[model samples]
Target: MEKCNCRSILCTQMTSSGPHILPAVSSNSDSNLQKRYRCSLVEVIDVGVRYPPEWRKTLIMLLYAVLSTLLSSLVVVLVNNWVPAQEIVSPLPDLFPRSFGSSAWAFQLSEFCSFLLLTLWLIQWFLLRYKSIVGRRFFFILGTLHLYRTLTTYVTVLPVPSQYIICENKVSGGWEVILKQTFKLMSNGGFFLRRSPTFCGDYMYSGQAATLILTYMFIKTYSPDIFWVYQLFCWLLSVTGVVSIMFTHTHYTLDVIAAYFVTTRIFWWYHTLTNNQDIVVWKGICHGQETGNDAHG
Candidate 1:
């Protein structure tokens, strides 16, 4: 009986100890799993994080503007030097009358103006951070004036028939006939203000009328004596057209339209590299306004 009691006691002790060992092993496994989970979470957070700065983006835009201007100036200079002046044909005389001053002067003046405008644009791009609203407005005006002058050359050279009295015919029908009549009346001082309108508005309405008038007055080679009395008037009108383009806000409609895409691309590249959130919204608004105007126009 004593032996049997001893054996039973040993078996009971072994069974109880075995149950305790299993619980300890389970607890250790749970602790290790928690440590691994915490480590994995930390790694995931670190992988998803991102950091960037705003000043770098602004520098990039400034650099782009500078490089582009330099390259364009170099190309223009090379072309001017390499090509003979006689080889260049002024598109104005062939389309209108052959009476305008030497085509060479027009070509040289155009190149000079292009260089001046590009220099101004570079200055504006670099000084963008310091420019006030008024400064920006002034540059905008200058850019518009420059663009108008450039486009005027192209428009004058366009193959379309002139709207001046020289090109008029006896249609006697269609709205074109009425338009020609109205233009003639306006040119001869029949419109408002008692005298002929010498504004760009009038000149543009007559469609290349300014070119015709200038060619008639200043072209020494083919001009008749009748054009001499109005020489002063023609000069005044030409100067007025150029100055009006500089000061008037009305002509900037097209400039703003073009500037939208250019400025937005610049701002976007700047903001992207700099990570600036403040000016991004404002730039977006301005860009939107330009786009809206372009679409409407």
Candidate 2:
């Protein structure tokens, strides 16, 4: 009888405490859910909170761009020196006549449009609340485009389309010549301050057309909600730059055609691959939580 009485008392105690225990667990779960919801909101509103600058990757891309540009310029110089001007064959029966009205102003106009696109992208980054992530992507794409240009130009040598175009003279020394030519082109500041040195045999694809088109692609993909008028202006600028490049006769028709094809293809391919990544993992949304777990593990 004493044992039975003990069993009854223990059962009563457990039944009484059940309500309190259950409520504690239920409240804790609700609190966790609320915290997670607020975190999601912050991620969406603050891009920097979700995406760090990733300076290492940016630096790598910048270095790649510089190297590829130098390599392309080096190839131009070597080709110019190695082949006699008369021996270099122009692509025969050129599309729309090789005698296009070449003008210095046309080249300058194309460069001016490219410069404007660059300025607008910067303004968007600094003043208009665009993320640097987009800018990083732009530079990366540009570097890739230039790398492709380097390979193409190296493989196939095309004569300068216009006789009026001045090719840089052969010079002694290897690295020194590359550096000098690259410096001269860079110092020209996209033909803003001075005429860009005409590098012969860079005719498989048009870099100006590629850059202008790339700018348009970035603006269209990232900032579709931006002012419609500004968007229209960008479209107009790209068209004008492309047409202007053609009139200069620095490149054959195939060069511009290949540029459009290659640039757009690479851009779309890059985004399509990257966008498939898991959003939370790719952006490091749980980095702090992971660190805390490791510390307290």
lDDT by residue for model 1 over 119-204, one digit each (tens)?
A: 43345345544334323332333233323433442343222212221222323556565455545544442211222112222121
TM-score of each: 0.22, 0.70
Model 1: lDDT of residue 111:
30
**Pick by lDDT: which candidate is best?**
2
Q: Which parts of model 2 are misplaced by more than 4 Å?
A: 1-49, 86-91, 98-104, 128-130, 190-197, 278-297
In candidate 1, which residue pairs clash?
A: 53-274, 54-274
Computed on alpha carbons, the lDDT of every model, listed in order, comes to 0.33, 0.69
The candidate 1 region of ten consecutive residues with least summed lDDT is: 4-13
TM-score of 2: 0.70
Candidate 2 lowest-lDDT run of ten? 1-10
Best candidate per TM-score, number? 2
Q: Please, what are the lDDT tens digits per residue for candidate 2 over residues 1-297?
A: 112122112111134344211111222355543332211111234455456677677677778777766666666666666544744554345664455656778877887888898788667666534355666677788888888987888777776776666767766687776678767766565223435445577777888889889988887676656578888888899989888888877778788999999999999988976786775465575887788899999
Residue pairs clashing, model 2: none
TM-score of 1: 0.22
